[model samples]
Target chain A: MASEIVVDKLVKRFGHATAVDAISFSVDQRETVGLLGPNGAGKTTTMRILAGLSPADGGTVQLAGLDARTQGREVRRLLGVVTQQDGLDVEISVRENLTVYGYLCGLSRQASATRADAVLTFFGLEGRANDEVDALSGGMKRRLAIARAWMTRPRIIILDEPSTGLDPHSRARVWENLAELKAGGVTVLMSTHYMEEAAVLCDRVAIMDRGRILALGPPRALIAEHAGRGAIEIRCDEAQRDAVRAALTAIAVPWREMGAVFSLPDEGADLGPVATLAGVQVHHRPAHLEDVFLRLTGKELVDD
Target chain B: MTEFRLRSVAGVVERHRVATVRTWKVALTWFLIEPAFVLVAMGSGVGQLVVEIPGHGPYSHFVTPGIIIGMVMFHALFDSAWGVFNRIQQGAFETQLTAPVTVTELAAGEALWGGIRGVISTLAIGGLAILLGWFPLSALPVTLLVSFVVGVQFGVVGLCSASASPSMSALTLVFTVMATPLFFFSGSFFPLEVLPDWVEPLAWIAPLTPGVHLARGLAEHSLDLSHALCALYLVAFTLLLFPVAARMLRARLVK
Candidate 1:
């Protein structure tokens, strides 16, 4: 894979507040990379700067070999963005919206109409093309937004939580579409908080917290590297709780205490301990990416 | 394949036109119906109270030129303020920021389009006045051109004001405080011939005062040529505001 994006030392400030404290990252061609972080973690700000929706105070961003500052038009031309919020026109029909976006990207009248029809069909919106965008359902709208982004035939596509605020069915469909995009050789970069979604979909993931990348690698590799053996959830009464903690610690297991639920991790290293804890009400489970993510970036909530 | 840079001004204008044209009933209501109401109400109620100028003819003669000037201000200010504010607040501005369109292009296109819409309404009112048998309606080409320029001048001012202000309410407040006063004090409704000298200085700065002067000049040759140079004053004011407004819009956006 080749690097499709290069962002180095990006900074942005609003008044006195540093929105994106100097940060850097890149995504490769034909790779589906995930940017995972909590809400207000500066993920959207970073993407916005990359998309040229806002200027970075200091940084260099090259997309498809075009420097964002010098060749912003070419940078914009090569990349497509599906913003966190749907930027659709409620007053226009679905087809018209697609055509307008296509036209804005320099598509000719005939080409725009044809592409709009194709995108509408691709997104399962062929029959609804003439209907107002406001009349579309949540899933339909999300699908439309994604489709609109596709009208440009971009080499690199950035999705900002493409499935945010969607119901289960809508989320599943969106994920499936994203998976299809990845399969078709389109480089996909996204920021999301859905732990399971990242684990299942991302070719590689970068776990971000407070504007910094804490951990990066394949999900299972991260789990195997940091989580030790797979995680084991145990429920013990007060009388035997100390014994379990002591036993786990004596064996050099890493654990997190959250109220009464204890999470002990061994991260795909050995299975002997699972057998030992089996009769002790310990349910040994395979360590998930969520486990790796939570381990690297502690689960404590930031100041709310 | 699509290009990386979007031609956003052309794109947005094309998009706006498509959307606006689709909603013809609503647009007509905006472009026609409401303006008709104002013209009828104002023309009928106040049209009876005035006498003709010594050489210009009927009272309605003065009213057409003045109403045209007033409509120019009303349409220009209203369109730019509400239009730009809505786009900025609604995230449409973000699209333009990402596109190939520069701030200058977007602002110019918006001001131009707003002026066009203003001109349309002004003409509608002008036609209504003629049908009601007001002015003798002599010259065509020159009057229309001058009126068009007047609309553009005011439209630029409105665009600059809207882009510089933080909120739509502030735009409205500024209009009420500065614009409305200028409209009345400029001697549009009543001639300034008999007014006290103290109020003379204030009228000098009123844009519509220059606007009215030019309009009257175009309509009737009796209003004096040197006085119509006031319109040139408006032209200079518009020229100065263009770059200032573009810079403000650039800063306000792309944040």
Candidate 2:
């Protein structure tokens, strides 16, 4: 596998604020990697640097081994960006918008027209070719933005929160399109705050927080390795809750306390004390990415 | 490489083309019909009051260049001001930034297209003036081209304003304090000879005043040294402005 994207200690500063701090990562060609981070965790900033939309305050960015600053156009030729905000022109018709973007990406008018039509069909927007973009739904506008990005046949596609604010149905459509891109061997690097999206769409994910990668691995492996097999909650009356926590923690057990409940990892731990009590209940389940996130990064992400 | 460059420009122009063509009615109305209405309304209604100064010719002739200047300024200013301002404020420029187009290419495409649009509008308005017996009728192409090029000058002024301005208030401040006054005092409406000598030097420094001077020569058929200087001033204005406007746009993009 060829390395398509390389960022070395990237940093971006906004006045007194350091948005991204010494972040380094790479995406291999044809790899669908996700950067999962909370809002304001610098995921969008990192993508902006890679897309050459924002300049890095420190370090270097190379796309397919070309310097982003020195040979930006060369690198841009290889990369397609699907921004979080939909940037489609409102007054223009759907088909006309794509054709213009196609022309900007080195296609002739006729070529752009043909490519625009094909893309319209590909995104299931064939019926909207002549309609104004403002007349389309939120989903259609997002699809158009995605289609416009891919009009140039880029070697790598970077999506910054592709499904940030879409409905479930619209999200499914975007996911389907992403699956098609993956099947066709297009390298993808996506940033998303949705744990389920990262777990489902990405081959591997880097869990980011506070401008650093806290954990990096495949979804199942990360969950299993960090959060264990599952969690069991022993919910008890107020008087019994402390006794439950004390019983669980007395054996050096890893546990969490929330009101009248004591949750512990179900990794073959001693549950003998729990069985002796009537209010104690053991519930086992498959671990999830959310659990892994909670265990490794703490619950502060939601707050941030 | 050249092909790619062309494509890059196409990309910027095309992104706006849908809106551009769809708003043809608006552009035509602003550039063509509205200007005609202003010319006809202002020319006929105001021409009756000219009291033609003996050597300066009919009141319409004097107002011809004034209307031409006003039309070009309106076209360019409107195009660059509202359109470019909206794109920047609404974050549409980000789309162009991600495309293969260079910032220079994008700015150039936009400014030139605006100039072209201004040319179209001003020509229609100029035709109305001619039909109303403004000038002798040989000043068509020179008047049109010179006035069209003026679009780039004023458009750059507006684009740079948008790029550097933190908000529309700042943009408005620039027009209020500087741009509007320059237009009024730039010898567009009245003869420079009428101005006091102290204010004369300051008015000469404004951009489009030279545009009026050059067009005046062509309209009157007297290609003298002042006319040549005015023509040269226009070329210089365009050359200096384009790169600076592009730089301002680039600065806005990364930040």
Candidate 3:
């Protein structure tokens, strides 16, 4: 499949601080790519640059085969961008929000109305069509935002943290809507902090930190390569933590600590010796993207 | 298939129109009521105290044109400054940018919308003036044209301020520092000749001065070289400020 989006050596700087630094990636047509990162990891910056909302300091972005820098109008016509901020016109009705945006995107009145109704129905917002956006629930507002994005029937949809603040149920509903879009073969590029969201929705995940992509591949492949087969998590008291570490080290097993929990790969590790350590509770689970993400981006707290 | 072409300015105008429709009663009330108060207080009350000048007619007649022009200035300033500021801060412009609209187009559209508001306010005041027999029916078109130019000029100026303003309070500071002085010094309430020598020069340099002169000349049917020169000045100022506003807003928004 031809690539729907291609970003090469993308760089963005805010005064003296670099926001996005020489990041490169691509998404095939209809492929959902998740930009997985901590806060201030440049995910939103990269999405903004791709959407032509902000200019890249260095590097090029090609959207649907058009140069984003030079052909921004044409590029924008093919893209539906949902920023991290809720960009809904609050005074307008949910239906009017979509319809007006449709008009802005060059849809004829009839066509815009039709598309608005379709997307409203698709997002399960048909019942609230006349309701003001400010009156809607947070999840409904998010769905409306996404529905507005889809109003243009864009070839590529760029969502910046689409479910950042929603409750789990709302997030699940949003995910279902996105899953339906993916089923319809719409190309999606979303930035997310939820490891499970990326795991469930993304065909490929790019782990980014400190303005650069540290790793990129399918979620399962990344997990398998970075996290090994499984992990044994041990929570232990502060005093016994040293003893448990020494015991694990003596057993020659690779391990890492995050707060009270210590994680070790489950490959031929002798758990009997480590389990006997004082004040330690051990639980085993299959390796996943969270492990891979921590392995790539590290467990350091990102300030913003 | 339905044709899809980029109509950035039209889109902005449409958005404004939708918003205005919902709030037009309040807008129309202010547009009509405020000017009535200003005209009654300054035109009738102030006119009673001052004798007529040699060239200009009654003080009421002389100040009516300035009041009309001042209406444009005030509307344009508030529309572009507070209006643009709210849209930018609320992420409305960001949403618009997601479409095929460029920042330049957005600025132009907003300026044009401000001009539309100015035209609406001018029509309201002009219609009242014609009914009261203070303004001739013949001068309506020219006065409106001048009002529109003034609108676009100050609209662009206001948008430029809005682009640089850091917060709502910063916008308030702009109104207080920049607009208030222009309002008082633009000869809307009194002639510039009454001011001190140094202050008269500052009044001449104020953006609203040329607009006042042109609007007054058109309303009074007193066409002259100075009136033509004032028109030229307003046109030049508008042309210069349009691109400046667009570039400044683009820099603020697209960065």
Top-scoring candidate (lDDT):
3
Q: Which stretches of candidate 1 lie over 4 Å from their true place?
A: A232-282, A300-304, B1-8, B53-56, B135-140, B143-147, B164-168, B222-228
Question: Distance from true position, residue A185, model 3, in Å?
Answer: 1.5
Supply candidate 3's per-residue lDDT for A182: 93
Highest TM-score scorer: 3
Q: How well is candidate 2 docked (DockQ)?
A: 0.56
Tens-digit lDDT string for candidate 1 (B1-255): 223223455675677677777887887776667756765655566666655556556666666677666777777776577667776776666654454556776777666665676667656666666676653466434556656766667667777777778876788875888678867777666677657888776776677788777677666765565565785687787778877877777787777
Model 1 TM-score (2 dp): 0.85
Q: Which residue window of length 10 is worst by lDDT in model 3 chain B?
A: B1-10
Cα miss at A29, model 3 (Å)? 0.9
| Candidate 3, B83-181: lDDT as tens digits | 888878878789989998888878888888878888988999988877877777888898888888888888899999999898899889877887778
lDDT of 2 by residue, B1-255 (tens): 222365566566565555666777776777667767766655576768865745566666766776777667766766576677777765567877787778888887777766776677667777777777786577888777887788777777777877888777767776678766766777766778789989887778777689877776677777788878878888888889888998998898777
TM-score of each: 0.85, 0.89, 0.92
DockQ of 1: 0.42
- Candidate with better TM-score, 1 vs 2: 2
The best candidate in terms of DockQ:
3
Clashing pairs in 2: A104-B11
For TM-score, candidate 1 versus 3, the one ahead is 3
Tens-place lDDT per residue, model 1, A153-226, is 88888888888788999999888887887788898888888877888788888877777777888877887887
| Regions of model 2 farther than 4 Å from truth | A232-284, B1-7, B14-18
